[model samples]
Target: MEHTILSLINQTNRNIFLTGKAGTGKTTLLRKIIDTTYKNTVVAAPTGIAALNAGGVTLHSLFQLPFASFLPTYGSVPLANELQRIENRTSLQKHFQMHKNKIQLIRNMELLIIDEVSMLRADMLDAIDFCLQQIRRNRLPFGGVQVLFIGDLLQLPPVVKQQEWEVLQQYYEGMFFFQSKVVKEHPLLYIELEKIYRQTDPVFIALLNHLRENKLTEKDMAELQRYVKPHLGTKTDDNYITLTTHNAKADAINARQMEALKTPVYRYEAKIVSDFPEYMYPIDKVIELKKGARVMFIKNDPTGNRRFFNGKMGTVQSLNDERIAVLLDDADVIEVDRYQWKNVRYRLNETTKEIEEEVLGSFIQYPLRLAWAITIHKSQGLTFEKAALDIQSVFASGQAYVAFSRLRSIDGLRLLSAVPQNGIESNEEVLQYAANKATEGQVQQEWEQGRLEFLQEMAMRTFDWVTLETAWLQHSSSYSGEIGNKNVYKNWAQQQYAKVKELVATAAKFSKQLDGYFRQGASVEYVCERVEKSVEYFIPLLSQVWYQVMYVLEKVYYQKKVKEFVGELEELSNNMGEVVKKLFRLQQLMALAATGKDFSKETVSTERFEALFMQIVTNVNKQMKQEQLFTKDKEEETPKKLNTYEKTLLLWNEGKSIAQIAEERNITESTINKHLIKLIEEGSIVADLDKLFSKKEIEELSPLIDALEEDSLKTVVEQTQGRYSWDKLNLFRKVYLGKE
Candidate 1:
């Protein structure tokens, strides 16, 4: 079952929900997917700790979403009334101010793995959908990124305040992610793993299954009653961690036990280096431990020896600022070392043009935390050898089941109170959804069918020229040079852009023909033959045109002592270089597929893909760095070499008007105005209406710009005719749109 699901993830672009009972190796399967899949992927979870446990970032952190209850607005553009109701004016303003690099990350993402998705609210999922669409400029679900949701719907549930739910209920059927409006439009492929790896006792497994379905029998009740002991809560035990429903109860238990210890305390503070954010801290910054205190390991041992795993119960035998020893159940004492957790984000490597995870910072700390007691919510992915259940205050649907499932067997569980008849609860909505899940045979059938569709989509995408065209257009529009005649580079880029636009038209016609062939029930061999012809046609056209585009730029840079535009030149070269690499890879894949090879088990490796294009420049930025482009002018004091936006900003700060700066900088006034607007949009500089516009100008153009439905400055200028210049309209539009 796990093998089939893994194949679906790699061979198709389906949105999948991987669910199972607790201890069904869902996390194990997730690790396998992360290790082996060739797609550019991002992993996120609902909360910080869950994110830490899953080795990913938080959803809110990844999306830059305000911690607010979102409303399910239908398109990328949210309904104005509903948007105002969901978030405040300030947050909405901030949401639109995402950094350009973050926007690029969103555009480059191919797969998104959301761990512990049962705790993801319906509105939150819709908000993620909306965010991706707005940022990636694509309206497909999650901006055309395949999403994999991993969690048990029978374990943890999403948290929503009563007041928030009152407002959200009208827009949603329930709080789970399946109830999201977008998920309803494009339903997820449901695959559940049935094997239980945590517990092997048949009787215990039967009881858990009954509890999960809320179908407890009389025999199960009798077995559970045997562990009920009212006096157990009063006892102090170091071997068993107490699991409770509320944080306050768990905190009190841990605090009391800590205070009772008479041993001297050893205080250790975590070593944080560089850009680790406060919210994403995996463990407490400072921990105070005593010799006999109970501790729980929060991370798996870094060594392959597997001496200690997460949630392993032990007692602190000895500790210091640098070293600590833990005694496990079998009288084996092991020395524990500090573990480092890396905070990472996905980025496109300029040299390789591959999406890679870049480590932003790391937090080094001991992996142990107080294990006297823990809340059931925090114990979602943890397992225990012995635990006491204190569930009289259970509040959520699966609270009791989550607490009970943490133990290996009934022998490891001690009940502090008799289980109420209604304690083993399951949401009716979850039950109804689970009942409709396809059987194993049906899943296999769908998987086989999806494989062919996946091949078709891959072939279509290879023929689709939109991505390459967009890259060329963006590069051509943003091209700027500090040395030589800038028109030379600009004209060349424009010509290439024009060529790409023409190719886009030609590819669209070819794609339509290919679709017709597929619609006629063409065999794989027939389609591969068509793909082979297309590849042979496009390969020479792209390779011959783009092979020396970067080499020419390199030669131009080497001939001059230009330092101001080194970064910009490299960036432009890299953008074009990435396009060339992608085009070549697409052709290569199509050529390979023409051999009638199966792609289910093996896809194109990076090495093999690069082997096809090594004759082209492998790394445009490598030589630039080695030459030390900026060192020669270090002592010249050339105002620190500002970018176009920065230069425009500096001139403005010197009280120069837009026209004056344009004349001084030898650029168009419209380009100068655009630079300042870009600076304002990035929050680098604030716009002052009094400094930017005259009263007469504001009073005349403000109403017109405000009333225009579209926010494009060129559109506003066109409507007003040649009377008003684009520079004036651009400034007026920014102020009127409240971006200032």
Candidate 2:
């Protein structure tokens, strides 16, 4: 069946869908095709964590859907400006033009393979198909693209039931009919690969197969005894042990596994419903000292008590003490203590900081390694290397069968518990409904008809080119010697062999059928044409042109408004420039004197500088108050409350640009410039005036600037004394003369 499916895939002109029971190797085959044939393939899963597990991007991220939101933002997608930002490389540009430009930048691509197809909603698939069609400008679905959908039918269905699933069901029903017919008519090379490698015991395999067939045998009960028996001897490395739910089996099994290696386990418990205590020290302090540390935590507490009791499981995070962290399969970080650290268990190296940064700052302390765990749901799709399954728990219809058959090789399995046949219920109503919907027969007919048509077309297209090539190879003297003869023989052999095999296979498979089975009127070209047309018909329906047009119109309108607004803002700012200059000058001088720079023998003291600046600020407030520029209540307020202008003045003194101070304080820098303009109006502070400073003033100002830059008052004082004459300075003379 695998080879026939591969042949069909090689010939199919449009998209293909593959579906089967769970654990059917659909994903495995899809990956094989991608690795061997498709080079430029992008694989995506529906959910983020699932994508991570599959080593692919999520469908939501690929579609650029907003996380945690229902209403999708559409219309003019913005192009990330590479010249404007460094991180824009991965950023998806919003506009269609930009998206096209980015697509054009890609060098080579052949296919897009989507896995977990059963979980995909029809609308989401349609959306993806739409985007591809528009970008490629081809009259085919996904722009004449080839897609392979791989998934199992029995696993969890799409989450959105009403819209997507219903649409998908209808579409899949049509495809399923086509697939089933192809399998029946053709020599479909289906490979079941029933060898359960994970569960090696023959008895266990028989038990599992029986259970899968809905027939539990007595041998299954006997096989489970090995796990249940009490041990009388020292534990052998290969000995199997069973832990019960009441016995706290999961944790005990984990502990025993670790103890076999002579390693200690670090245990921590947390109330899942409440916050972890603040004083509980972090895990890093304990695990750093030891290697191969086994850690277990309570996953669920059924009692609902405040404290943890039973129902804990052993889940180990391999710790890399060199990196000071433990690595979880989900790529979560846990800083571990020294004593409980496990070095041998983890793969350690210098972390890939670049890859970490690419993932939008998810802090992964250590790189990932393959993990082993029993997630009942996820285990459905996998065939393990070895398996130890316990099916003593209640089986809900198909659950037991699905769990048992997960083992591929008979010898690779160990059935830890017996299946209870009495547990199986024959729900006749449910069975009847399923039987009615089994449309598998109809699907098979359509698929066979499609395959026959495709094969007939290929056979008709075969020319005598191979015969001509073989003749040429034989006659050409340039290919003389043993190598030439060998090459000629190889060409002739391959051509003759292929021709004979195709004729014999076709005759053996189809000759037995009656005249009506051939469907003589139905041509392969017609089938191909029908498939092509079906794709083209959906192209226009999926195009998002209206959304794009609306986005473009909105963008143009906003650009015009922004241009006008910016112009008015610029003009207002220019008018306030002079005021800003004057205020800055006064603030700078006062700031300089207040820093204790000795200007002269009678230079202003630091106290006097501060007092004078405050007085000046007070006077400005009073002036503004007199003009009633300030809105006031009838009650009197303090001078501090009245001094609104001082906030702007202080901002200037702190070396803030006039524009910045205005924005922060929510006032116009122009208004601030107006106050400075007033200072110029009164000739209190000069505009663009570089006054010739006395040596005393320079000495004082330099030290203050140095102090501010260095953030040290003591250093400023030392630099001041070294540079200036203390004997002649007024403030210095006062101290030296012993005057109060």
Candidate 1 ranges beyond 4 A from true positions: 74-85, 88-94, 234-238, 467-484, 489-502, 529-533, 551-603, 608-615, 618-740
Worst 10 residues of 2 by lDDT: 348-357
TM-score of each: 0.76, 0.36
Per-residue lDDT tens digits for candidate 1, residues 320-403, read 778899998667898988899988777775555567778889999988898989999878778998899998888888988899
Give per-residue lDDT, candidate 2, residue 412.
42
TM-score of 1: 0.76
RMSD of 2: 30.3
